[model samples]
Target: MIDRPRRLRATPAMRRLVSETRVHPAELVLPVFVREGATEPVPISSMPGVVQHSLDSLRAALVAAAEAGIGGVMLFGVPEHKDAIGSGATDPSSILNVATRVAAEEVGGALVVQTDLCLDEFTDHGHCGVLDPLGRVDNDATLDRYREMAVVQAASGSQLLGLSGMMDGQVAAVREALDDAGFTDTPILGYAAKYASAFYGPFREAVQSSLVGDRRTYQLDPANRREGAREIDLDVAEGADIVMVKPAMSYLDVLADAAASSPVPVWAYQVSGEYAMIEAAAAHGWIDRRRAVLESVLGIRRAGADAVLTYWATELAEWLR
Candidate 1:
């Protein structure tokens, strides 16, 4: 057996028989970016095939993803204007809220509509939370905004609220707000182990973020592994229906830890910069694009993620099918 490693890899049929983790279309959730007031789908140069879609285009994209039988679509909004309080985030008429409504209606019961309940894309300061007098993210103050966001998202028909803001107590805050607002059935997907990562560079472009400073004040430092577990524990204790690890590839250790310990489903987000790097390499013919994409996703799956939120979700599912 020690000298016969090729036996399992000898043929496609053999490989299939021994495959421990198979990527399924229903296990992929596409992360989509929708910009307010966009005339057309604006291609993000850094992300090869990704675009900041107009609302109409967003509806179309969701329809396609739903038809492909993907699990869901995670929405990120690029508001036309952002403010100190990220007023647009809680506004029922905000582009993100409207897009939620449109996607929910367009997909009907075919897809699980989810929304990013974060202020980064809607805040002029480009932080996940509202700033305090010291210009630092005020965790408690931010909780209020998240509460409003929960109701708005629920009213707009979001089945899952992606609480990507890494502020303290966010899960409990949003959970209470949603329940208090009579949206008791809406689930909160807590971004429990979000790291302050260089991998978010392409995400800034995807969301057209106007960030001025770093998010190290709130987001976990990349070096701290134990803290990531603590964060996951806190989120789980605070009523998170599911927990997630962001920038999945580099944090597979954290992902594995979370998956091993989490009481609920554990998910991972294959962030934008990770997508861009593979795309860029493939563009220069350094790697086979299709193979690399599936491999990267498979690696995440192999790390124990129950589901993956990926920019390539729809395309990858279609290709696999």
Candidate 2:
């Protein structure tokens, strides 16, 4: 008789028993945006239900994330002002810092509070780091800003810093700064394999980015798989407790490579554009929203991701439980 694979797929109980990758509430981390001076949450048009939150709204979201049993929340701040050097990023009184303090006060240690230590949202040019006179991203100078920003974020009680700036030597620089400031326990989540991709379109709108040009100068090129591994290696050697691949769906190859080789935990960011694609298609009745969402995340997890960052973290946690 011919072998029949259908035997294993015949029952839900059998399918559940053999499932290789699982998504848990504690493995999901929510990414949230808090805009300065907003009295009410501002809905991002391109992103459908996602909002740029006011302080009050942000507090509410933090509480929701904790209640949903999400392991962490990654915070991004939309400042009312921007400058050449992204000055607000390092300012103690900056909206991002203020929001971090608020999150820490609200959630305490019940959930890990993470902050984006990138200059993109705060910089007028919308680049991830400071630019020099020639208009190119100045890596060394940006590392200095990262160092100061690390101390301030640690002071604001962020348990993990999402280092998304893509600056060379940034991980080591920030780690040194944190240690020198008596923040020995603070951890770094390095966005080691972030790529310069068109998939970040929705994120630009969500953050109200002022970018006039592409970030190809600093971010990893999508075509280079080996380069991604090299970057992950550098981050790990520089003390990144956790390493991540951004725009996760398109970069699963890179994610798997890092996960296979790295000693530390590997993370993947199911970025804004990915969320919008599924939501937009589902809204059009082209796909089953619930099933598609679960399948997408499951695929990523099966590709060797330890945890995933998703905009639907809260809702998925509820569904997963």
**Candidate 2 per-residue C-alpha lDDT over 141-166 given as tens digits, one digit per residue, 9 for 90 to 100:** 99999999999999998999999999
Candidate with the greatest lDDT versus the true structure: 2
lDDT of 1 at 157: 94
Cα-based TM-score, every candidate = 0.98, 0.98
Pairs clashing within candidate 1 = none
Off by over 4 Å in 1: 1-3
Say what the RMSD of model 2 is: 0.9
User: Which 10 residues in a row give candidate 1 its minimum summed lDDT?
Assistant: 1-10
TM-score of 2: 0.98
